[model samples]
Target: MKQREFLKKEKEDIRILMKFAGIYCRENHSGEKVPFAFKLFDIKKIERKEIALCSECTRLLTYGLTMRLKCPHDPKPMCKKCETQCYHSAYKAKIREVMKFSGMYLIKHGRVDMLYHYFK
Candidate 1:
């Protein structure tokens, strides 16, 4: 796929993920809504990135695999949020590579189930 097409899909995925994250946060954080700052970050004027991660896993729950899901080794391992933010800067690259590999594999094997299984 062209870069533009991939970016469009990525943006849509980010939006959907942000919505889900917002809902989850509101339910968990004392029934208090998550602030806008927490929902999405503007990586660029045209591109946005969702910073959603499970409080426990710190895993990126929104995008297929993105920079946000890193295990940062912060001083306070006691804090769930801090634990999630530890920087594995390579996480995004790893995820992108895996996704690209899967795409190529799917083109050859044509199995939708592969994607479904991973998402599930």
Candidate 2:
């Protein structure tokens, strides 16, 4: 699929999954729609920076049930451009935290096979 179409679907998927996983939404001070995609520190009200996944990774995550045990980064895990844009100066740490939380959550919830990719 084209990038725009892919992102549209992924965004919709994120909305639904986040809701299914029990997250709420709020409007930012500027009155823009913001989903609960970010953790506490990345909230729109607190930071103005909209946190998001790389389009590629978001696509991968949208199919959360089917990722393989291969690191998308391969030699070194690199952030997708969009994720880089979102975190700005703190991109590195934020991505790490996201990865860390994802791994732990999957493991805690008994998704052991999925955790393997994050380890790499």
Candidate 3:
């Protein structure tokens, strides 16, 4: 994939994961709600949508985004299938929880189209 397309996919994946994390956070966290802008990689006008998430979710989202941006795979493989795992143990567990929970949430809610990345 070209750089542009890769970045676009990464941005969309981050947005999806963050949305899941936000849903999980809204149910669990009690801190103040905050806005997080997806403005990494100097893409300028792209991926600027702001998500309202708790501080802990925001940190997880940021960490996930950073890993996505720095990821070495082209036509990147899923994290589970990758040879190297970039996330710390705790973060890895947290992300798995978020992905699994949100994936089921989406599937149960009939958001089946959203499962392609999560399941495959």
Candidate 4:
């Protein structure tokens, strides 16, 4: 893929990852949330610059984003459909939990547009 397309994909994936982590953290965890410092790459274009997540959720989000950035696929396949399993088993399970909870919450809360991606 071209650089533009790759960057677009990165931004979208980052947004989704952050949103899922934020929702899951807020709903399931309790603690003082701190702003996550992005150390892998510059995310200036990502709108949510100050995502405050619990330590556990922040670690999960950081792992997810790292996997996304290092993905080997040219046109990245969704992790669910990909043949190569990049995430560790623990993180994979945690992300699945996050996706399930947040996806359902979004749909019930009138984020109808998320339905396609949720089912896709």
Q: Indicate which candidate wins on lDDT.
A: 4
- Write the number of the candidate with greater lDDT, choosing between 1 and 2: 1
lDDT of 1 by residue, 52-92 (tens): 33342134332422433232342224222454644345644
lDDT of 2 at 76: 28
Off by over 4 Å in 3: 1-6, 42-49
Reference-based TM-score of each model: 0.30, 0.31, 0.80, 0.86
Model 1 clash tally, residue pairs: 2
Q: How accurate is candidate 3 locally (lDDT)?
A: 0.74
Tens digit per residue, CA lDDT, model 4, 6-86? 377677778778877888888998979998777756554584456789999989998998888889997888778899999
Model 2, 1-120: lDDT tens per residue? Answer: 211222333333343333222211111123343233442122233224343444433333334312211223333233343332333345445334445555566667787765443343
Best-to-worst order by lDDT is 4, 3, 1, 2
Q: Which ten residues in a row have the lowest lDDT in candidate 2?
A: 20-29
**Model 1 TM-score on a 0 to 1 scale:** 0.30
For model 3, how does the per-residue alpha-carbon lDDT over 1-120 read when each residue is reduced to its tens digit?
Answer: 224544667766766776787777776678798877555544324445556788788888878877877889888888888988888999999999988888788888898887776566
Inter-residue clash pairs, candidate 1: 72-86, 72-87
